[model samples]
Target: MEVSRSMKDIQWLRHRVGQFLCVGFDGLTVPSHVNDLLTTHHVGNIILFSRNVSTTEQLIQLNQELQTIAKQGGQELPLTISADQENGVVRRLPADIPGLPGNMALGATGNAQWALKSGQLTAQLLRHVGINFNLAPVLDVNNNAKNPVIGVRSFADTPDMVADFGEKFIQGLQSQGVIACGKHFPGHGDTTVDSHLQLPTINHGRPRLERVELVPFRRAIEAGVDALMTAHVVFPAIEPKPIAATLSRRVLTDLLRQELGFNGLIITDCLEMNAVANTVGVGRGAVMALQAGADMVLVSHRLDRQLDALASIVQAVETGELSQDRIDDAYQRVANLKKARLTSNRRVRPWAQLIEETRTLQHDLAEHAVTKLRWESPLPPSVRRVAVLVDERVPVMVAAGDNHSPVLLADALQAVRPDLHSTVFRFPETLQQVRTDDLLAQLRQYDFVLIGINGGENKDYLEFVHQVHAQSILNVTLLLRSPYDAHLVPQSTNLLALYENTPWMAEAAVAAMFGGTADGALPVRIP
Candidate 1:
């Protein structure tokens, strides 16, 4: 294929030397605009999010169409298709698909083998759906429990634990020819707010960062991570610019590229995140990110901004504000990543086989992580009746119309112990309306009381657990959502951190209640 250099080709030549192209598809369908963009711009890659995905079949069709579009555009290169499949809340594919357990659950197992299996299984599923890159196995050591965005998304609170898991995860993914990206570089685990809504600042000194925040990232880089996704947070102590890492050359270039010796692709977190969009126009953010050493700018949410950004970058090269060498460096990195994908031998494992393997691992890990936090008396081998309490504070379900209670937990418990009678009580309504005498009367009838805190800050669930504990009922609290609620059951003996209310976790919890395995230690310290 002879590559021509017309005005459009010349623009491509200028941008292609060091720039990456971002193309957006409309759901699972490849729109004309995307086709035109790929043909005209020779865009380097595509990123898929939940909005772009509906089913595995649709995703595979979309990717095949994208490749056909690129080939017709006179670009003979294989495009890198990436997705954020961090399991749990960040899963791009449907839940019914062979999704691995969330990072926190994997971390709780305290076994690198499980982490490796998770990465391999995730890669297998992604590869079958035509995704070459997984922006996953989040390397962030979420030390801060209050961190709104990266709580259960992170593997653990300690850097050593996260690093160990992340290293094995990278190995497993790469072994399967799936490029694993260690994300939110420099760290997003310590922030108290979501960067998608606002720019967060981390005030830790450089030494502190090297010790705690940067440990997992450094380990991941050492393990040969294919890419590092920059965070949107600012570290005021390290850089005086007060800009997010995505736009700060001091952070991306000086710290990540130079200091860390990371020769792999430096990708940015979503440009549509509030940290970038609120500070600078999306187009400008793209340009600045490239200038800051980001090899691939992820403008996943804003196409117009991406187009403008590409234009600005091309102009900058022409005007000599950005050097051709820097452009070439970035372009080479992206091209190399694509080349690596081409050389990789990715084969689709049977979905049934993958699911069975993943399910067994998830069950084993969950069994190990179920901590017996509080138990006043010996757990009765047989319970005639059970009263279930579900927390109403947090949004348990993802979509708008879904109910936010732990009804599944009640069902699973009943399935396991058929003889035990189960009654569910929603909060406020049960607290304000249901008489204490009646509740006590009901509690007296049941041999055990199992409290499932839906989701919330530690104190709210803690107070609820404490009240249940005070009643001298056979108290067993199951945290169906966040481990943050584990702090409240300090004195209770039967506490289990099921991480999330997924069916796998719930099923595992039921088995653990029947004495499956010894409860594991809490990976994160309950504060």
Candidate 2:
């Protein structure tokens, strides 16, 4: 007996339900268990991270294998391979791969074209590696200086600047066939708590949100971004306590869908994060997110949680808790995205030379973006012995295993000043680990001191930097992660906000230090 057309339609949708999920797997290579999601479940998207990337060659081979597995599954849409290629600290790509100068660095340049070029270059590289989705150009306005998570990831402090640069970046990426995801919608810029730790509450009323956070998102939507990721933070103005934009009808459906008119794929930030799991647990949160308005639920980092979450969504739909129409709508939006970008007929480029060529582009962006907030004239000569002090808070590169961009800074400085004697000290994050007396002694010995503030979100490091600067540390140049760090180091000294500790920015900083012209202007205000 032949199956009825309605029955076939339902079967298509059952496969599509799996497409609604964008899940991650366990290792740097294809794990045997991933076949469970691939063949049996018909999952249509896969997220990659440091645990799943060791080298560019590995990544390329991994993507090829993933595509083969996905193709063999016989799904209508190809698996949307994606990664958080935001560069700087959040970059998931291998360390050697050329990365953009991150958002804040681009913002400091105050040139939308630089951001566009950055996005385009980034897309070119990610595409070469077989990844088509880039969760990037984070449009969050970094209005809150002490915001634990967003800091340098945000483009600017003002909505207008964020909007202008964000749209341009989106244009650059999608133009290159890589999907640009404008993230943490309704904005994750103001929160103090990290979603990886707990749910953050953003009490900004609709008016405040409209003036600040919502502006960039509206601009992104107008600019035609392919995807928008929801924030896990609760907004009292839109929804009650505990119901974040990730799982709120008011925020997601009523506000983003109806008011803002964003028809693109709406993805949830990783459900396995403490923000969602602590509140609703991953499985229940996934169901609620689908019910709320999310098109794709991202269950990254935990395989058990991913399977459980997918199972929950399917069960919820079967039980009528989540409307089948919602699933169909979401699945269709994802399908449309795959149809548009993940084309089978596109010519893939040979990337052996791509990295070298793009490294030039990445360096240009960093050079154009290094801000000279206050440059002391006749900045210390290359012959002078230099001491570089890195903040204890800098995070190690996840995939490169132990890639510290500051080492690149030291190497660059040494190359430019062959006679330069350099002493670089890594400050520990804890007060117990800080050897202030020992550090001060080295500062006194060197002809000049250069402090590298990597991830300067901690107030403790600010105070530490202030103490060193107060001792009349002569000819010091502060290479900052956030200009907000200016609060600690006064403008009386040579201050430069590279915006992030990218190697390209580090090379740019070295150039500016040795009397090279720095044309970068401040992109954010600091008091």
The lDDT of each candidate is 0.77, 0.80
Give candidates' CA RMSD values in order: 3.4, 3.3
lDDT (Cα, 0-100) at 278 in candidate 2: 85
Error of 1 at 183 (Å): 1.7
Off by over 4 Å in 1: 1-6, 9-19, 23-26, 376-378, 395-405, 418-420, 428-440, 457-466, 489-491
Listed in order, each prediction's TM-score against the native is: 0.90, 0.91
lDDT value, candidate 1, whole model: 0.77
Please provide, for model 2 over 67-178, each residue's C-alpha lDDT reduced to its tens digit, 9 standing for 90 to 100. Answer: 8998898876778999988876578777668776778877877788887877877888888778999987788888887787887788888999999999999999998899
Error of 2 at 391 (Å): 3.6
Residue pairs with clashing backbones, model 1: 18-327, 18-331, 373-492, 373-493, 373-495, 374-492, 374-493, 374-494, 375-493, 375-494
Instruction: Give residue 65's error in model 1 in angstroms.
Output: 2.6
